[model samples]
Target chain A: MASKEKVAIIGSGLIGQSWAMIFVSAGYRVQMYDNQPEKVITAIKSIVDQLNNLESKKLLRGNLSASEQAALISGATTMSEVLQDVFWVQECVFEDVALKQKVFKHIDSMLKCDPILCSSTSFIPPSQFMGHIRHRSSALVNHPVNPPYFAPLTELVPSPWTKPEIVSRAKAILTEVGQKPIVVKKEVPGFIINRIQDAIFAEAYRLIEDDVVSVEDLDAVMSEGLGMRYAFTGPWETAHLNANGMTEYFEKYAQGIFDVQSTFKPVKKMEGPTAEKIIEAMNKKVPMETLNERRKWRDEMMIKLSQIKKSSQ
Target chain B: MASKEKVAIIGSGLIGQSWAMIFVSAGYRVQMYDNQPEKVITAIKSIVDQLNNLESKKLLRGNLSASEQAALISGATTMSEVLQDVFWVQECVFEDVALKQKVFKHIDSMLKCDPILCSSTSFIPPSQFMGHIRHRSSALVNHPVNPPYFAPLTELVPSPWTKPEIVSRAKAILTEVGQKPIVVKKEVPGFIINRIQDAIFAEAYRLIEDDVVSVEDLDAVMSEGLGMRYAFTGPWETAHLNANGMTEYFEKYAQGIFDVQSTFKPVKKMEGPTAEKIIEAMNKKVPMETLNERRKWRDEMMIKLSQIKKSSQ
Candidate 1:
């Protein structure tokens, strides 16, 4: 049934290719497009390679084989051709606001049917670009983390003008493609994930700045300590277990928590001596020159974790 | 060899039993003691069961098999008997400050040589109880996360009076036991892990209270999104990859980060409506009656994650 539905992925970047794979994995006919056709061709090749890799690892999302999923993806010569009969559109262009606004405006004029217009913007909210679009009611942000196959979260943040049913449709589509979608009711800068990340980074920076712990020690505290629990559960659930339950947890530690939180230093800009010091330390473990190697290592771990999560369930 | 060393673990609760398991796995003789001899016997039983379980999962640390590790652990009726000829001691008592002070004073007076008096206190800093101890120089906080066998990170936090050599020795012992030990140079409340945990929890509470996202959706952002990378890398390494490098990351997004961080609401007491609301949501997923079920699920995931980490490397 999903094979009868058509979706278009604009920009043909890493995110676009990943989205194409996701849609195709769910048996959707995916039309890939880029302003420069050469980029789209490159995306197609990378998508095939990625699908083959996912297949070898047995981490592919759907029942379809790699080649079968690859067969459902096709490159579009023109933007109009990409939007021809698509039920949904995923725009993965550059992060610049003006560029997104221009491309979205163009797509809005070209769009015939009211398909869910989703932007793969991690930081930018939909309100930044959807104001001038004709189909503004359908526009929203469907942000996916990097390596979306392993990190399957999709944050669904709709603009003020976005229709409620459109958000629901986007959520259902993402879920259908094996992506976990979290709805951000109102538009917030950084949305949910980045907000939580920045919160952690803020405290991490403070720890380093105050010399409470070294960079290596700080990371170890997470990867070996907190990250172990977080891999399977979240903060609230962790709190629930740490004490008898959430209510008991508050009864025992709320005052102490408030006291500790009060001492948390003000957020500093992520520059100056502190930032340089952290960069220096990070370089020692995963040097800037060998980042890609480290990233490949990270992705391999993620794949294994995905498999572990599946089997444990 | 580490096999020649003997360690005493006072108060044979879960943490003490776990510490004994860690020490025994490293080929050390562990003498477990508790106020009630029955609790010590129960701990010995639980340790055997846990070691057997770890062996079944192929997660038993060190070169020892399940029964071999179990043989290295024994229950002691008397505190002096537990401490006799021991090279180190891990005091795992109730979190009450006065009770800890009394225990430390007793342990301090009973010390034959200067065995490292490592307290397994998570929140109470060593200073709170170590000031009056005769062998205060050897005292510090060697805090371990729950289920220390799988989540092997230990925070080595030294009191102001603690000798530098004691810190190094405690770190070495923890390392020998296959634990990832990170130094907390200065004593701070909540140490490193809890401080970071509280920071995350503070923001999580605010997000929930403000209704930015539902409890379930907020957790999905971590378990599915940020956690995927965090399971392998820390925040600093994550920042390094999100942009060109750490320096480039700061150059690009530091200001925006400061802006968002500034907007973070003030820390409030974690009680009243917010706490109840979170409990309500958490109970829906993991009911209070089934906490043991949820905790088992968490531990199983942790074991699998540990396996994945080892295999990925």
Candidate 2:
């Protein structure tokens, strides 16, 4: 009756399609636009396929049936059509800063009313493009991990000029669509997830570079060891549960922990022989020729894991 | 038919009990000894309860039933009895360097042969205690995570004097019992897992202490974001799959990554108000009073995740 609270999704790429599905699955009316009109039809087909796949696996989010949700996603013929009465626009263009700047400028000129402008860039900060825009106060980055349906975290990062209320609204919208949104308070490079990821990767590279452990065994140290706990609990909760409490944990292992932390080497530039060796080993396990198959396996496992996490909670 | 391999489990606490269950579940005759005999009986009861729980969940690792495995674990009247005819000994005394040294010294004197002597310590390096022992060549640390049944990673850390062959054999034995063993090539403090854990924890502490994110959101960045991928793929494989390969990943994001890593603050000591804030927040989610309940929930989720991981593979 309230016209389903329209959302405009620009760029019809993988991320754009995912945003559309998420909005529609939550009963929002979604209008998708692509610079090239033909691509929108292809995106719709892929979205349908993905929705059906999730439905078959019973992993579809929200209460809407696959066809019903798919029916809610429609392509817009013009930027004006896409922005028509929509409360938000999700930009999912290529990660290059110049192209993103141009697209945001265009969107700013076309919009009739102020709408929440969210970018799906994982690297480029909002400050680069949003500072000169009329709707700069509403622009922020909603960086999602790949395959948003399975891994539901969206890192909500706001430009310095962005309104605080818009950040809260974005998180609430993501929550309605069954996404877990975390805020990055200041504009930090890599935001929260990738910054942590780079930290782990730097250490992992050093271990392999030093030949302390082979690449395979090094992987097991995480997938089989630390990952088991981290998959459910974060580092803080882990410390709490590992001992009586945080204070007890520090009392027991603080000095030893410090000693180990000091042993970590400086960040190695990821290149040359070490990178080649890692790539070769990874290819042996998941050959470059069939990388997609391995990714399929990874996604299937992630879906199953997501289900387990939800039920357990 | 070959005889069941015997393993001596000294100090029947939680870690010791887990080691016993794992050994007996693999059809090994497990001889368990504790400083106080009454504690062994209590441990056997808890072990029985754990095995039954695993069995009911259909998550039991080996062919043996809960009772069948429980029947294979017996209390030793003395250290000599526990060491008699045992091919290996897992020392699980309190996590004190001196206490562990004392226990290893007693086991060394009573052993029938130069058995593979491993300590179940999460922190203390084997080099500290094993250096002065008579049978130091066979001594190492076989660190198991808490509730070893669900999280089966065992870090095999060898002292300078530890025999290379013994390390290999220790790995083989752990593998036989369905435990994933990673060899720490050198005796490093905290070994591989804890070192990486400390790195992540240090970053997490800084992020929380700096007010970049709330304690809850920081944990969400891990459990909901990076953790979903890390659960199955390690950092290496993740980078490989993220791009065409590891080389491409580095080519694109290495500079950006280095910039972010350089921004991370020095490790904050886990004391004072920051520690208290984290503890209070954690307690609110999983009350310290019902810590065990939260732990049980964690274990159940882990078991389910393990099953999914195995089947997906």
Candidate 3:
């Protein structure tokens, strides 16, 4: 009634629940649909519970209480029902391409009008799901981070056929909410975040395999050296800020980067004394027995950090 | 006069000043030393000023205010003068291996009655400088992050011949001074942080070279995507939390990582078309004309982030 945007989330899994949290927190009237009615209900309640946790931690920005937070929930029973009134539908179902084909066929049949339908798949190509759809021009991927109540990055990946108008509208809506969304001009496996994460993980794995440093030592490099800078800036910006400017840093050190990159051999599977050392280190630092407890700690820390950002701003 | 530990910081450069802030903040009397008498005078005033700035930002976690903070600064004209009766020495000077060799030779000669001696060299390995020293067993690398006053990670790298007691002592002192230190059992170039940073950078650089993503989009992936998550959890811990457990997660996906690793080709140096694109993106985002102002912004943000970590803890 207040000109609020309507959002439909398909597949109420962990990522779906996070999407629900993000859309709800960003002031969208969210309708989460799952084939199983129970999952949608669970996702909604779980999202609400996460909101309450944020409230309790004083991490939710802007002084909204748990009771005040409950008003954003709106539910749906079917994909048809979700597409009935929504301006956007984000598909977060499993990553199986065949299953996506089946689901997209069904959604395509129901999508009589264009409403910027987007997939939330992390690894799958957008071509798989959108290629066969009748309204393929409106479909794309809008991958989001997990536990979206704390993390605030969203990737707006568009298929080639996706209309520029639709992207602009989606980008506007995302900005109106609090999340930072960056449009990926082309779709690729792992989108942007996962791609970057995967690249770093490969070398980190190789470093351990080479017995260059322990896992904890590797983490320290991030948490202390690069992580400290990265949490505030990106690699390009870091290069830019480190010296006379990024261009100069590049000019001075481009050859150095090439040499380092050249030496990087593909990592084989984790093996030998290294994997055992990592497992031992992890068990000592964060035991399997206390994983749930540690996860809780992590969530709490994330909540507090988000709160810090929200309040400071 | 109190029962607190005494630590000496040799060389009054940016790294030395940062170490002083860290030591003072962690409740230690910092004896700051520089070869040049003028540098000692400049460093004391500069560090005191920085402490005042930290106080203004509510970032300083130490017990001392700006005025009394000056009392903690014991700037000595010589390394031997500052190392007198101290429990440990953290040397920060020129990064040249030759300079480090000459300086460490002097430091080892001074000896300071068997105090743990460490260098803040970012690149040079500890063994290269420590092998010839009489007090070699007591020497290792205790490399603190640039501006450790704000960023709390310290890497404690020990050479093969280094004594365990010296490692423990350095680690303990680093901890006592509120640094998050990760011990490197094996030393490698760029160590842990730079290696990972270098790898990600190489990949990102290639993306630009391949004409896949613009510089802004590349940075956006981190600033918005995985970076937001990384601000909360390290990669290893992230793996641990993503699945039921770390070991299970690694066991299942180590092969995928190996596969991805196999696909990675070392990046060529940035030249030709991509360089122009990056220069365009960077010039748009940050005008080179305002670099000094931007540096201020970077330092301010670091201070705020550091303060946030302090407050949360």
Question: What is the per-residue lDDT of model 2 for residues A68-130, given as tens digits with 9 covering 90 to 100?
Answer: 898898999899999989898999988999999999999999999888999999988889988
lDDT of 1 by residue, A93-187 (tens): 98899999999999998988878899999888788898888899889999998878678888999999999998888888888888999999888
**Local distance difference test, per candidate?**
0.86, 0.85, 0.74
Two-chain DockQ for each candidate model: 0.77, 0.70, 0.52
Over B141-196, each residue of candidate 2 has an lDDT whose tens digit, in order, gives 99987768788888899998998999999999899888999988976667788888
What does the interface RMSD come to for each candidate? Answer: 1.1, 1.3, 2.4
Model 3: how far is B30 from its true place, Å?
Answer: 3.2
In model 2, the clashing pairs are: none
**Residue A285 of candidate 1: its Cα lDDT?**
81
Compute each candidate's TM-score over C-alphas.
0.97, 0.96, 0.91
> After superposition, which runs of candidate 2 have C-alpha atoms over 4 Å from their true positions?
A1-3, B1-3
Candidate 3 lDDT over residue span B23-49, tens digit each? 777667788877788988888888888
Span of ten consecutive residues with least summed lDDT in model 1 chain A: A1-10
Highest lDDT among the candidates is held by which one? Answer: 1
Give me the displacement of residue B122 in model 2, in angstroms.
Answer: 2.0
Which digits, one per residue and each the tens of the lDDT, describe model 3 over residues A1-313?
3536678888988888777666666566778889999888877788788778767766664334555555767678978888776788888898788988888888889875668887877667788778887888888888776655556677788788888888888887776677777777776556667768878887777777777777877766665556656665688877777667877877877775666667777556775577777777777777888988877765665555455445544
Chain A TM-score values, per prediction = 0.96, 0.96, 0.90
